[model samples]
Target: MYTLLSGLWKYMFQKDEYCVLILGLDNAGKTTFLEQTKTKFSRNYKGMNLSKITTTVGLNIGTIDVGSARLMFWDLGGQEELQSLWDKYYAESHGVIYVIDSTDEERLSESKIAFEKMITSEVLEGVPLLVLANKQDIETCLSVGDIKTAFSDCAPKIGKRDCLVQPCSALTGNGFRLSTEWLEWLLTVLGSNGISCVM
Candidate 1:
């Protein structure tokens, strides 16, 4: 089940809606980002506390405001048990954010496989993909070029289907705005083209 951390969710939504799915390997900080978003919603995030927050079960839904659009964000757990549920939201996501722990070199091969399988699926074949090369503040993370090489085949071919390989740090808020803005622009463009998607 999903929970809302803010009371302003409903009143804030506009007709131009978009859903962004955040997927990555286990311990990729997907859940932490959502919790930080909750703290941002509460407007009291000075140094932010993460003690009571729990790892996402299978999926969690959160909301964010980007430009004039209300973005519905789904944070998906990347565990073996949840692999089957990936496609369930594939068709729903207009944009995707794939996170990776920058220092985890051992999992690079595994990440490439997960990305390939997800992109090759009939449902996620054409949506815009954002590679959040997360945890960049630390050393030993793969370069953005490295990830692009990993998923070269999955890059978008046209208007709303293109993929952007953006490196970001979920812990320090770096590149977060870019992630939101990219999604906002892509959503606006897609909506104008009559692509009706659900999140």
Candidate 2:
């Protein structure tokens, strides 16, 4: 009777869970973005000091509840060696958030290469993609249009997925709310259709 009651309680209250990946080159502010996201969405979550955050060496996990859905974010390390392990989590991910350091003009091409490789994977086909141009608070950072233009060649590889390149600053939390709202709306729509994954 106790077990039955517990199960019933959970089933009635549990939010639909979705896995999201936060991918980008090292120093692209993936961890910072995750922290800011958590701080913003979870009312009682006092996130880490953004300034003290360092490059992710392995993986950082965070969860945020939006409406009836819970988004579980996998913030992976972006170092060259660590990037090889990203695909290991691709099979279970519901969406992908590819972050780019807009201020790093020299590495923009490198970032594009990594993004192209990730999006073209069969496992991630049709998964919703959110491209964040981080560090938008900087005066000289590349605009969203510039990044979109730089990534134009790879658009065909992205297929028919719901993809957007948004300008954001993880440090200042600019554009963060809008991005999460987009995810919430997308997830709600997909959930209503009885689909767990975007495909």
Candidate 3:
């Protein structure tokens, strides 16, 4: 009976929860990425068709349980009009996943500006960041290093935040495993910092 009681206690009281925000410019595949994540982690999750995905006008939310932690992702719209509302979620987010379209070289400068602005926000100071240079399957796509260099201006502004830039093809599920890698790192960071994961 002691083992049963201990299991019950852990199930009831030892859940770790975290909030994550997904942001990027319009048509950068934010919604598709969210759907892919849900499908990847959820056993019975029946989300929208990947090929039919479209621009997210407002927000898309998803939750997944890995180990003892429950991660809640708030995928905010990336349109120019919706970008201003991103700060509303920053204060609550434990980390951020900023997506970039590596295949769209013409918009690299624009994305860089947006990234710099987000990282510089006071509310998001010290928040860990995962920058996904998506669309790696495209032959003409920019490399992960190039994407990182483009956002190099935001380095100083990152300050205490942990940051990583990884290449991914959300459409083809390439490099998706990196998501789990980052989540593990995030847990370690929270533990070392004594940060509460309840939110």
Each prediction's RMSD over C-alphas, in Å, is 6.8, 2.8, 3.1
Each candidate structure's count of clashing pairs: 2, 0, 0
Report the lDDT tens digits of candidate 2 across residue range 77-180.
99999999999999998888999999999999999999989998999988888888899999999999999999999999999877777788889987656456
lDDT for 13 in candidate 2 is: 82
Q: State candidate 3's TM-score.
A: 0.89
Q: Tens digit of lDDT per residue, candidate 1, span 1-199?
A: 1336343564365346778788988888887776666556434445346555566678888775545565678998888678678889887777777787767878877877777678777776567666777777676777777766765665543235665566776776665574456555556655664554433
Measured with C-alpha atoms, the lDDT of residue 131 in candidate 3 is 84
Instruction: Rank all candidate structures by their lDDT, best first, as comma-separated numbers.
Output: 2, 3, 1
Ranking by TM-score: 2, 3, 1
Who wins the TM-score comparison? 2
Candidate 1 similarity to native, TM-score: 0.74
User: Which structure is stronger by lDDT: 2 or 3?
Assistant: 2
Give the C-alpha lDDT of model 3: 0.83
RMSD of 3: 3.1
Residue 93 error, candidate 3, Å? 0.7
Q: Model 1: how far is 128 from its true place, Å?
A: 1.4
